[model samples]
Target: MQEAEDLFPAPAPAPAPAPAPTPARDHSAAGHRARLRERLLTGGPDALADYELLEFLLFAGSSRADTKPAAKALIARFGSFAAVLEANPLAVQEVKGVGEAGAAALKSVSLAARRMAKGKVKGQPVLASWQALLDYLAIDMANLNRERVRVLYLNTQNRLILDEIVHDGTIDEGAIYPREVIHKALDIGASALLLVHNHPSGSPEPSRADIAITKKIMEAGRNLGITVHDHVIIGADGHVSLRAKGLI
Candidate 1:
């Protein structure tokens, strides 16, 4: 019995007393996120820098991780908070740590902004709210990489009836036909219309082609007794009104 006890070493010395549990990992990141939330609630959005605002937005997509690096990376890539919000979904997803969920969150903000701007002119006389109209158009088209031609169909009282895209691509006479503009106006029974397009070059100056196309549409609308209110060209810098410049 003594030899057996020595060989077994007295039941392995009670499994060496088991090891003590290690403390949990530090939660400094969670603490920082909580502080950010407090500041946002107490100080409002203006209290934060662009990256901080973006970080707050990123939290919706990545709740478990520190989002400062992702926010800073997005701002660095897109140049501004607005630019990031307006960026194409695929382009936005190119940023590191921005997957489908993050892209959706960013796009949701852009859509809300557009709807809010659109509300300022909807069902109202667009000419009366000309500044609001300009703001809405700029938000919709200023940052686009390609040209798009849209027509705002207005009722007899100059209230906006429908805002429709007539052509989407390079803006020229061939792409934007005078007949189509007039026909659409007649179809919608719009008494007046506004021609709008954007310049991808960031300059609001109308080229000779732009002038020629506007005149063609103006003539067609005049023949049809539909008033052409204005041809507005939007750019990243500003917008140009052809009627104000005596081009239409």
Candidate 2:
């Protein structure tokens, strides 16, 4: 009671202003990711646009930077979201800032999409779902670094009985042997067959070797009473069908 100033002792020096609350750093990137995740979960499939879906995919790898530009750039470069996902890992690396993380993200997404498509076609007559089969083949074979010749062996019902890799190397006529193709089909007890190969150059247009191999396979299939359904050449850009072009 001797003095009011002495009693309070200057309010204890104002408690050092509470240390300014540590300035509350921003976490916009993390916040954005959380929001995107919520959209995917609550809104279902229609919740995301093409780019938004791509953005969500990139978030797995590029969580720190803005993903909008990367997503847009990918679609712009590849001409579509599907094409970007189907692109080769090296091809995807061509994009700026698309390092190991980005390429891995795209590759994983493409592989997951392929698995989903394969599940849809499983235990079903593949011939009836020709478009689905082509889409699956296109996504799987496009953008490979090396050529891979795969054969889908079918039974009498045109169902996929076996899928085998007959040859993997450069896609040329001499690289594949008609006898080997015939023997593999026979070994698998396949009554019908569809041939597929990839072009690393991204041009599905058939080369002389492509045509020759198709002819040899078709001839062998004929002699063995097996149907040669189609020869599909997949490239980075698009796919070519021998049956559609009347080459088979």
Candidate 3:
């Protein structure tokens, strides 16, 4: 079968399959994240270092590069993990690699911890759960940059009813009125009061004016039949109870 020899040429060979394109960035850190999570789950809370805890926090907040560097930087800047959580959101955001979302994540943890501490006081005797109350208040007011006055109103059972900010600046300078404070308590049907204020200077010790003004508030509440439980001064150092100090 003498076909024309030149007519039929061999079919062209198929193009070689393209090799799989390589990923530009390494995903080894994801494996590290998994390991950290496992360590957290199996080794208990204290297993992870401060930097590692911070790193885990950044995972849900940031979509950038490896969070280890950010975590390390945060620890270095704030000096500790607790300090990092206690820091102001603006201050936290000022750290490189920690954006607004990351800062919010940190602050949300702080709020969650405070809420958990608060739960320890809720539905329980406030006097009996003093330490838990202190923990809650410390989380809330310890790291403030300016003095603030808050009032914790309680029912007859000594359970917290309302947490109100009565003053925003220096307690001595603020126009804190005892009549208004008593009226608020009366309006809310609160039978007791726990005065709270923060010291920016980190000293929980009460000043002379602090004692004097507290006495005034106590006297005002006394006439109104509302028991003033305690005036707790919160600071970075700790909290002080004026009643414990014999000041009110």
Candidate 4:
């Protein structure tokens, strides 16, 4: 009772500390995109730099973070921005933080590019747009990890009529059958054909088996009265045309 004031003294709780603000990392990705969009709007075609163009392509995949490091890393690893876009999905994913989403974005861009290239020559003679055809083929084939042999069945007008994936396996000479190829061509009503395949080792150089297979396909097409336009071998490095190389 004598020390009532002391006994009833109120205790004070400590005040809560203020939260520290999160430091802003350079919004490099957003800034980069903004600059590119501005340039594209202000200037006409060819306004953006190659790296900036690549950066725009990459922005779709890395919406949350800076893509400059990733794009730079890709160009650095693959030697060029074109090479980066040409890299296979697995190879593209090997870069840090380039997960499935990034892979899909890159592949979608490739597919779209191919569609546009094909559209340029659609309903027209294929020979007239050979560059477009080569571009479509190179972009589509350069990234494959496995060996795949495909046939482009064409009509008499040399317009694309059908694209068939005939065999997917190791590139041994025996895997491709001229008889089977001819039969498929007949079934598809193709008057002409283009042979295409990929090399997993990143070398477009034709193996003995590759050359033999090309010869067999050429012979079969000839006997069936179907023209063989080209035999193209694709690899990560690039593509080689057997007909162009005098191998067919």
C-alpha RMSD in Å of predicted model 2 compared with the true structure = 9.3
lDDT of 1: 0.87
**Per-model C-alpha RMSD:** 12.5, 9.3, 10.5, 13.9
TM-score of each: 0.83, 0.68, 0.80, 0.70
Model 3: how far is 159 from its true place, Å? 1.6
Task: State which candidate, 1 or 2, has the greater lDDT.
Answer: 1
Name the TM-score of candidate 1: 0.83
Pairs of residues at least 3 apart in sequence or in different chains that clash in candidate 1: none
What is the descending lDDT order? 1, 3, 2, 4
Cα RMSD of predicted structure 3: 10.5
Clashing pairs in 3: none
Q: Write the per-residue lDDT of candidate 3 for residues 59-102, one digit (tens) a residue.
A: 87866458898899998987667779988789888888888889
lDDT tens digits, residues 45-160, model 2? Answer: 68988877888887777758878777888888887787788777788778876767888988898889899888777777888998888778877777655788888889888899
lDDT of 1 by residue, 16-97 (tens): 6667899765578787788778888899558788888888788888878888888999989877787788889999888888
Per-candidate Cα lDDT values, in order, are: 0.87, 0.80, 0.85, 0.78
- After superposition, the stretches of candidate 1 with alpha carbons farther than 4 Å from their true spots are 1-27, 170-174
TM-score ranking, best first: 1, 3, 4, 2
lDDT of 3: 0.85
**Cα shift from native, residue 152, model 1 (Å):** 0.4
230 Cα displacement, candidate 2 (Å) = 1.5
- For residue 248, what is the lDDT in candidate 2? 66
